[model samples]
Target: MHSRRHPIRNAILVIVGFVALAGEVGAADLVAPSVQKTLEASFSAKGQATLARLAQDKTQGLCTHYATSPIPAKVVTEITAMGFATIKYPADGEYLGDWQRGEQIAQSGLGKQSSDDVEKPAGGNCYACHELTKAEIAHGNLGPSLYHYGKLHGDNDVVKKYTWGKIYNAEAFTACSSMPRFGHKGILTAAQMKDLMSLLFDPRSPVNQ
Candidate 1:
């Protein structure tokens, strides 16, 4: 017995298939000269959000250039090296700060907008991408659950340095990482970075407990 296929369902499937194909074609054509000109004309710099921010760095440029395909191994190495070069270590050889302040900084999602005050401190907004503590139920899962960060990775020189580097410039450790280069881009202060380090390293921090 031949089962009858639903014509409406088949039609919908065909439409969806064409839409997907169109989307792929659109993606490939998005970087065309006309699109670039439109984008350039559409945006204007405001406050700290300068027009220069729209310009991609070498790593970003490579990522954009290879958006439709796999990035070459040589290009990946180049990007990783470029990202690594941006990292700046602490001057006084200190890597920790108040976990209490760190918690505040991580939880608060503020600063770095055109409307925001440039003098004010920017937030890490850690909660937006990670689950730091069991107490905080409201959190996103874009990144790994760092609930027992310090407990999992013991407080040591190597661990501390690695954590700092990761926060400072995530692409330095993982090429094309979504995490912002907070320290490298001057988005977060040294003190703020140290506080975040404490949040991740201090045994007493909520991240550990």
Candidate 2:
């Protein structure tokens, strides 16, 4: 009799193979003359998408370098320092805004593509990686569930500042983080960051409930 095949094990093996391939063909390999020529021939920048976007920043470069392995502690520290230096707190000392608008922003998944309207404001699309409220059942598990973020993290000044920095640039807290640097990359405005703070910290917001 033939032994039974484990589907999950097979799937994991396939994933491992792909990851190995990616490790061999690291992101830097894409910069090769032949690869660059092929990419240039295949894809073209349009609208908000520019050729400059193809170039990797220091943080992204490090992440790509260590894509297959864990980033060294020293490198992580360097990345964290680089990210921390980029944070700019609100000038008005106000860190909260309309929670309603925040909710809207969190739910929306628009902007930042070549096709997106340059005039319209961008959205955080927070729900894509977090479960913010009980009503919205649709959410992803790539990141931790933030259902009771304010309740768990508290609403103190220290917590407020930390949260703001994390939102502005997640790499500051955890180097090579998959989370976007919202404020650092100009993906969201100061007012929008304040609004997200309100959504996470305001007692009346559904996120806290």
Candidate 3:
């Protein structure tokens, strides 16, 4: 009588082989220079947006270089220092603006598109990732929910500074935060950031509710 092999064991061996093959394929894909060339050929600069956008900045390039692992402590410190140096605080020392306008900005997902007018201001699109208000049911969980932000942390000076830094350059807090570096990348103006702060901290704002 022949000994029969277990079907489950056979299946597991096949799966392992497939996984190893996929890993090899993925490694080969990264080595293909034509991939970058194809991407470059596909995208053309239009309006305020340029082909240069395809190129990563220093911080971005560094992050990409260390994608498979945690960034080194020294590099993290350097990046944070560079980001912190770029922050421009309000001249009058005011850090809060109209929460109502902020709500509108957060809700509106318009601006910064290739067809959009560059002369006009941009929207924050904060609601795209954060659940700011209890009324808004639709939100992505890419970032942590900021609902009751002020209620939980209070509007203290330390909290205010941390909020500003986080908004200005999220990478300042988390080395690889998915949250857009709104202020640091010039995605949002300082005034717009102040308005967002009000929305996060204002007692009357639905975020606080």
User: What digit string (tens of lDDT, one per residue) describes model 3 on residues 65-93?
Assistant: 45555778987886787677777777778
Runs off by more than 4 Å, candidate 1: 1-34
lDDT scores for all predictions? 0.78, 0.82, 0.76
C-alpha lDDT (0 to 100) for residue 20 of candidate 1? 37
Q: Model 1, 165-190: lDDT tens per residue?
A: 99999988877788888999888999
lDDT of 2 at 93: 88
- The candidate scoring highest on lDDT is 2
Clashing pairs in 2: none
Model 2 ranges off by over 4 Å: 1-30
* Candidate 2 Cα RMSD after full superposition onto the native fold (Å): 6.2
Q: What is the lDDT of candidate 1?
A: 0.78
Ranking by TM-score: 2, 1, 3
Error of 2 at 19 (Å): 15
